[model samples]
Target chain A: MATPLLDKVEDEAAASPYITVTLRIRRFNPEISDEARWEDFSIEIDPKERVLDALHKIKWDVDGSLTFRRSCAHGICGSDAMRINGKNRLACKTLIKDITSFDRKTGATKPITVEAIKGLTVLKDLVVDMEPFFQAYRDVMPFLVTTGNEPTRERLQSAEDRERFDDTTKCILCAACTSSCPVFWNDGQYFGPAAIVNAHRFIFDSRDEAGEQRLEILNDKDGVWRCRTTFNCTDACPRGIEVTKAIQEVKRALITRRF
Target chain B: MSADTTATGSTAAISPVESVSVFDVDHPAPLIEPPRKRTAKTPKATRGNFEMAAWLFMRLSGVVLVVLVIGHLLIQLVLDGGVARIGFAFVAGRWASPWWQTWDLLMLWLAMLHGGNGMRTIINDYAERANTRLWLKGLLYTATVFTILLGTLVIFTFDPNIR
Candidate 1:
């Protein structure tokens, strides 16, 4: 019975198609060393699997010490944003085959490089201190503001008004857009793209009475004025939020005081 | 658990804790100071509408400068005999008219302010040190003011008959 079970497991392993891929990760263990270093791990995985799967495999089977942040693992939680192949992306949404370079003749694959997002303190391997990012978010007062008493039923809004800020509503609080910004990388004081994008979401909302207040906050020296319109935020946003365009809208609102 | 491990509590149900703390709770790790973090010394945002006005001035002055500059360029470099015709007398002839004086005056002020504001933005963006930004902006303002004043004086006091 034991032999049959062992034979069945071997047969399953042989039946599945797996390809060898190398993951080149920038590892930082403060306890071990003060400096970060690059480490490589080779794993057998399916090409269609997400990059998160490969990391999971390496951590579970190869090195239990490997660390990264992930939750939901479906791109909604926005916890696993990292630099993949020099671009900011959610690891859970990136496929191995999509990012890997394969040589057709030799059937060889180039290693996928992974690193922590820039513009934030890296706590450990692929884990960054999110407090700064969240601090910027909280500074913008990202919520509906009204002076009058609460509505007995519900606040009403038009379809067009809701659609006005539809794009920025998709933000998952991921730092992908903010970290990819060159300005933020150089100057941490700049409110960064994510903050401006969040401010835009409310500034254009028809029902939000405090648009002027948010605009004033963003009009500070380090606010929306710092954006150089590099469009890196737009490209880095996994949720397809037009991050730069939203920032422009906020700037316009500041100028005209009209949504 | 072994006797040695029990004595040290290293082999308790929980594994041995790393002896070193990766990060200190008192002093959190930050590659750079947060930009908007407030301290007792931090001043309020008293700079109301200055940046907004500057941004608007850049665009408005840019539009006006295009007309003044291109017209001036066309007259000086392309209208008559191009570069060769631009002599001291030619400048005096243009400055002789109040219309041309206003035009040239507008061009100098707009261009200087426009370019000066651009430089200010660059300093704010690139200069990492506070002292560096202050010194650079100081130099920029001094140079900009000197150029504007000198240009205005020359335009106003041009002597057509001075050989």
Candidate 2:
């Protein structure tokens, strides 16, 4: 009699409209312990809520200790890139409904594992130490160096000239492209795709005066020469950047100068 | 013989090894590809094998790159004189031995193949138009073959003393 009653209650709960998703987010508390582990979190989520929304809900409503970074809930900020369902993507753009498909009759929920992207030190949970990444960006001298005084008017250029390096300029300084690089993973000194892409932005710019110096910096064995062109950077780029093309342009520049 | 017409095009200038072509094999050479057929699709067998080989190469070369790159770091940075020891003499000394030469040759070949194969994967994935893919790969393969040949030539034809 008791078993039958329990089964009736379970059947009723299964047929309800409200569904709960379980996010097995990896947790790391460096000060507390040397070991890291996954903590299971079940939250009642609306079908339209994103994984980032759920993460915020968990952080604000449920647990204060669950760590991650997000800014400008839009994709432009590029502060919230993480591994969702074994792929690097922006939390803002990834919707829960797209990632999870439910069988209406069976009522089984597909669980997604969320973690930080690989090849960077995890500061806490989804947050990584981005200092080194920015250092590499700065090392490439990502600036427009003009020999003339400040332009009196907006720098006028032909449409084709701007379009030449337009693709490289869309980089949001996101680590998605850099972290996805295998060369960056093995050799930390290698100027990864993001830096090279930025370098290419100026290398192809018609108004820049430092092309020779920049080319010299990129000619080192650890510089542009080190890029293996695996194109993971291109595949992982959320902004749809032509990363390999930029690197090829740098290679061409170096070769042209060499001959 | 058919290469005589195509050789007149800009393709010859793009390749650093100026005289080499697939059709004319009067001398012993590495693999020489037949002149590309504009109307034909890449033969299914070669296409599939090349793609498969490229994919496997990323993983295999990635694993070896890790070891070679790490070993290179240990010797150059972590060892005795560190960055100061790296110079023309250091390279000259290292290349003096067959072991080091072979090591560098393998590194050069593997990295270039790994990189060139990686770029081929990207080209297949992205370059939408057939002509775009063909020309881009033509440029890529030309650059890759040139670098590989130049590197091999430099290694084999080392001149310790110069005027």
Candidate 3:
């Protein structure tokens, strides 16, 4: 098995499709030192491969102590969200060629920077403490609530009503949008875009009867009012949730009391 | 063999019990505090519509201000011989009409409130400390109130002929 794998790797190397890429990772370990530092690793890899694959290569081959969080290796799980080249993106979704600036004349490429998402405490290297993000999510009451007897069948909803909140339902509870927000970076108390997006999902749902309660909860001082309409959350959302638009809708609902 | 067995028995006696657990259901590990945890010192949510009203007021006043401000600017700066024609006499002549008085009054109030609210929002966004925010807002409110009052008095009790 080892001989066959080595032969396949050699065959692939002969194609010369690989380019040298440098990954600059911001590392932090409290057990060693309190301050975080940048570490670089240069590897020869296919340009079409993901930044996550490069991280894996560095961890597996170069340094076994290199740490980061990743699961599923696909975009759907949202476990590998990190700041890639100063923008919040899923590491698995970001291709190496897209982030690394390639020079045609010299055949050189810029180093891809990977760091933990902002506005959250870094646990180790790329992993962040997600407790606060989840706290905000929980505070929004991101679920349907109803009074009176349960319906024998499902609570009926029209196609148009379902479409109203269709965009916000794609959230994967990733901190990309929240951590990208400038307001949240300064004041963590503010319920960030992800929470507001989740609230919008339930607030507009025809089956959710607790819309008023959730609205009241979000009407707090640290709620949607803090959003500066910076559009950063919209730009950072991995699911293309139109986070800012959903926030605006929530604000409108608060004002008009109409979905 | 007897001596070796005695040494082994003594070593086993020194070892701690394996059945005893450090943490159990009754005495568990302490929970880590959430970064943005709301403590007792944290103020309760106002649970008011003040922010919504402020947001809406910004838009509504903005639309009205566009018309009022543009009309005032055109009259003062561009129309009827431009800035050269504007003087004490021009102001008195404009204030003689109730329509102009109402326009000026509306413009003064709306502009002050709009700008003041914008400053309040900026203070809230940037000010990290609660005391800092309070003091800055106090100063802003004082300045805003003084200006509004002085402007209102000037508009309402205008003595055009005062030397």
Candidate 4:
């Protein structure tokens, strides 16, 4: 009787197998050591679980010292962006099954290295200090600036005009697009993509009257001109925004001496 | 006996391999990626492969950029004279060397291409109208190719002592 039960359990386990993937996370503890080192965790997980889920498991069970920042548990928050398997991606959205399926030889998966967004100080395991990212956004004056009095009635906008700036308005203040940019990585002064995209949102707005001021602010060496349009920002944007398009439009606007 | 069974039977009978010609007429195949005949041959519609290449260029260039950029920072800011020493003389001396020239050239070329391709990708993905894409990319590529060629020419043929 026991033998039959064991056989049934084994058969069930074989049919729905759980995969073990190694997560080689970079560990830095100011209290422990001056330098950072890689720490590997072998965890069994369902194929559909995301890397963010794996990190949660590691933090919850495997090791308490592993530190990272995450919110909303979805791609919208953009808090969980990390270098997974050498590419920058949002941890919540990237399913482990998709990554492992690509590996033909070893259905086994390699450790998905998790690190903070580059070009910023890593506060801990996967959280980088985001002050610099936000500073650039602030410098761009992300809020809409209207020269005249506020609209007393509902501000009317044509459908086509509204659609023009629709995509840019989807930005959730997530710095994934900004941090992934190489130009921003090189020069801190560069306004970066997110800031420019925000400025675009206001600049292109029909009601906004501060386009010239914002354009002048963006005209500096560290402003819109620094964007080399690497598309890393686009790839890294979990929001599916066409960031470079907004930057190019700004450039064209500046060149033609238009808004 | 059943209609569904007969339909399944007919499909099975006509194997995909055997009925490719039959399938071609009814199914209107995915726009066959334009054949790559050298310049002599002009295929009907230029599939957006040029744009695709520009897309791939961004990724490849981005990877190379990581190295070029990191090395550049290490040399210019962290090493020797640091930020203060960088000036026209420093640039002139660096450009004097073939190795540095090649490095700078590669950096310039890769950075510009990466950036241009990135902007191209942006134009295709965002600029909805055909004419808009054309004008924007025309300006972008014109500026990019012009800057790249001019920069390359200046780099190799630069005479520092010109009065």
- Tens digit of lDDT per residue, candidate 4, span B1-163? 0011111111121123332333333443232111121122422222222433443466678999899989999999989869889988888899889998998899999999888876765664455455887999999989999999999999989987865
Q: List the residue pairs that clash in candidate 3.
A: none
DockQ of each: 0.15, 0.01, 0.12, 0.01
Instruction: Compare candidates 2 and 4 on lDDT and give the better one.
Output: 2
State the lDDT of candidate 4 residue by residue for A149-173, as single tens digits: 7778977889888888888998877
lDDT of 3 by residue, B69-110 (tens): 999999899987999998899899989999999999999999
All candidates: TM-score: 0.85, 0.58, 0.86, 0.58
How do the candidates score on chain B by TM-score? 0.76, 0.67, 0.76, 0.66
Candidate 3 Cα deviation (angstroms), residue B113: 0.6
Per-model i-RMS: 11.1, 32.0, 17.0, 26.0
Q: What is each model's TM-score for chain A?
A: 0.92, 0.87, 0.92, 0.89
Model 3 lDDT per residue over A1-259, tens place: 3456887888886887677877878876544444566777777888788989888887766666677888888898889999999999999999887888987888788778899998887877888888788888999998789889998997889999999999999999879999999888877788999999999999999889899898898888888888899999999988898999999888888888832
TM-score-better candidate, 2 vs 4: 4
- Number of the top TM-score candidate: 3
